[model samples]
Target: MFNGLSAFPLTPMNETGVDEQAFTRLVENLVLANVSSIGALGSTGSYAYLSRTERQRVAQIAVECAGEIPVMVSIGAVRTRDVLDLAEDAQQVGVKALLLPPMSYQKLTDEDVYSLYQAVTSNISVPLCVYDNPGTTHFEFNDELHGRIAHLPWVGSIKIPGVSVVPDEAKARVDRLRAVIPKHVTIGVSGDTLAATGLNAGCEAWYSVMGGLFPNTAKIMTDTALTGNAAEATRLSRRLEPLWALFRDCGGSLRVIATAAELRQFTTTPSLPLPLRTFTGETRQRIAAVIDELELS
Candidate 1:
């Protein structure tokens, strides 16, 4: 379950609250696409912006819709107590795993993060994936710190950030970390644009935001790479470079994906949470143009 494409869907919302119907459609689509697993309430899902009640509801919805497909729910919160509470909530809904990042207001030391993982892993019922998304949480995980956390029981995977795009460098990066962490714990790649590079470099999984939006496209690239056809996988990924460029120009993936989701009718327009606006005017036009040019559905 942790070894292949893990698609993370956006948690759709409207003026009222969680858009249960649309969220359901997203999860069902992933199930149909036959993704390796579904990661709910991930950064892609806007977990940090939601209230605890909303997060729990989303977790229940994901697991209920996923059926036999593994569901990994994010349990990252500001406080350890709330993270534990979320872990219990997710497990209660039968989520196969949990995704956690060291969310903190103050700068966290290596000891702080290691201890955080130790506390959460102590009583968790399912496997946990360490979400090392430095872009949002602002807490970076060094290889040594990841090794320390991976030593804890139930720490089954580490979701590292993007590696160098160059194949050899990317492989070296994965190999370096592979040496430090326990052999049983898998290393997954996060950055969507770098996924082909990461996986071709021998990373075990692709924890992908784009995969959530377009699972078939992701499945094709992932399948091709895993089969040892690196050139075709790189070709497939390069084909989406325009979409990735939009992500860079339009201020990260959240809004750009929200736009794509809206265009694709997977969610209502303006699906993002409060204060975070979706793209508009020229930017939206460009996104739509790229979508058409790439024949993205």
Candidate 2:
């Protein structure tokens, strides 16, 4: 049921634990912006970094704040059993769907990946979405594996992160996946910078990080692209280029978005777990310049 921009918000954290007030505000912001769906605890949400209780709290808050908008909770974990447990917990909290990435400490084989999904889908009553984010999981899904995953019972959609830096090449990959995957299964694209090209390539939904902070802007771009308004979509994409560049230079969107959120006073500067650095002063200034230039602040 993820058909348009599904906002993947960063889980706002404070010293003690999840900043529940800030997290609720962020989710409410997405709903107010009318995002197609809310993806709680996705990569952007730092699912792996949070404890089970923290994640459950995040999911519950998102579902509570989302109102009519669907909430998709990421149930991915290093172990299949943990994934299944998360899936069950999500169901209890009235989650709309489960997003599972094939995660492992060591490299995983195709069969291993397939088995992990199979185990969860077989147990969970809710629909499951395959999240193939090679950048985070270090596991890639080939075309054959995609076809097989799409055929699995209860699997509804696949989130493919746009890997190619070239626009045409990224589109080509989306086209190829669309051709092979089951017609019933929707192909959603991630990678906010390439999202316009991906939507133009016929991806039905966008699993977006930027959308979490600026859903209205993302919705306009995706809607324009989906409706064949190429010129309008191109303009919107160009407008977002500076922010996208900061995302790349800062290493990821988590810190950049968190910093933006803090600047806007949406939330306090979150305390990320150790080993994950906050944005540098120079980077924050650059981000501030882009935000001001875009009139996002």
Candidate 3:
């Protein structure tokens, strides 16, 4: 489940509630594209903005739509009890794995994170993927902390945010991580722009935002990079430089992706939850141009 392209699709929504139809279409499209796995409620899925009932329903929809394709749902929340319940909810729907990011309002210590994993792992049956995305969570995990959590039962994979873009530095980063985690736990890289470098550096999986929406393109990049064709993989990533540039300039991928999705007619405007708006004006025009030029739609 952790290996290869694990696509994280958006949970598109509107004023009423979860846009079940659009969300289902996204999941069904990924299934058709045959991504290695479907990560339904990861950060790309706007997991943080959803209510419990909404999340549970999303999980059910993803599992149902994915069919034979493996489904991993994010169970990350600020509270341990909430995390536990979320994990159970995902498992009840027959999800293949769980992704947990150490989210906290108060700063989290290494011990706090380790204990949280220990508690959750003991209770859940599915494999757990450690989500080490500090940009949103505010909890930067040191290698020592990762080594500690990696030892717990059911620790299947570690989703590192992104490795160094430089080739040697990227390999060194993955090497250092591999030395700490158990051999059974695969190392997956997030951050779509750096995916080629990370994969060429030896990470086994990609927890990708782009893969969720544009599965065929992302999968080709993944398959190429994993096969050791460094030049071609780099070329593939370079071709998408326009999209990556948007990710860089816009603050993050969430809103930009939402805008792209809206342009493609996959979802309506206000695809994101309240208080967070998708791009408008010239920014939206630029994204639309990129989508057309790159044929992302």
Candidate 4:
């Protein structure tokens, strides 16, 4: 299922087209790291920047490479038709699940979000995971909104990013959600720092972009934490903190993945979409020091 450490890999592209070779390599590395699952076309994958056909091709390749491992396709577009189309494409390619965010760049009421989920569920057969990423989607989904949406039969999980934007707001929100959300439906915390706390508080899984950098380390941390081995988990978590910090101190998911790739040598070019720079020289130097200090590579 999606209820574990899901490594969201960056969708690799080069001058030719969607780089299937790199995509294959990334998937192979993640499976070897013992990741519970993989999500293609995620925030780290630059989902928004990819073309419709490219997204479909990447999804197919992910499924092919994963073989038995589950593959989650992040499908959220402006038009409901487009979303359905992508979902159908993914389902055809044997994707295990779909992760959808609310419509972006527009104001959507609770009803609007619900309707989108309903439309997706009615058409798509696989499980649907709703991502409540207000940081990017700009739609702050409170408990009531999420509760209503979760009632839909196909809804599987909710991905929430916990950060202290307001006074103790993140923890408060997590508490409320853990109380209200049905125990059957899983809640996955997105931030690395909050994973342990969220799991202790009721989060079933952690959707980690940081995991791509140090998947083996993350595997050790999550496995230990899940089993109540706090001391060992904390030790691994602290060891991973430096790499995580480098990613946190960045523009978005792409910057984080690029920085990690720079250290891990996952790809030759750690390029991000336009308007986002390739990280500063000072940041790069600091990241190198952190990687060397921690021996991340």
Q: How far is candidate 2 from the true structure (C-alpha RMSD, Å)?
A: 1.4
Model 3: per-residue Cα lDDT over 118-232, one tens digit each: 9999999999999999999999999999998999999999999888989999999999989998999999999999999999999999999988888999999999998899899
TM-score of candidate 1 relative to the true fold: 0.98
**Residue 35 in candidate 3, Cα distance off native in Å:** 0.3
Clashes of each: 0, 0, 0, 0
Show where candidate 1 strays beyond 4 Å. none
Candidate 2 lDDT tens digits, 114-214? 88877887898878889999989999899999988889889999999874756678778887887878888998989898888788777899899988887
Q: What is the C-alpha lDDT profile of model 4 across 1-297, one tens digit per residue? A: 867688888766654566677778888888888788887888778778778898989899899888778999999887788899889888988999999998656799888888898888888788888888877788888888888778787788888886443325655766687676666678887877656656545566778776755677666667777787766765676676776677577645567567656556666564455554456578877866877787652
Worst lDDT 10-window in candidate 3: 288-297
| Candidate structures ordered by lDDT, highest first | 3, 1, 2, 4
**Model 2: pairs clashing at backbone N, Cα or C within 3 Å:** none
Predicted candidate 1 versus true structure: per-residue lDDT over 1-297, tens digit per residue: 688899999999976899999999999999999999999999989999888889999999999999999999999998899999999988998899999999999899999988889999997979999999999999978888988888899999999999998899999999999998899999999899899999999988999998898898898998898899999999999999999899888778889988888988988877988888788899989988998898763
Q: Which ten residues in a row are the worst by lDDT in model 2?
A: 269-278
Question: What residue runs in model 2 are displaced by over 4 Å at the alpha carbon?
Answer: 163-167
Clashes of 4: 0
The candidate that wins on lDDT is 3
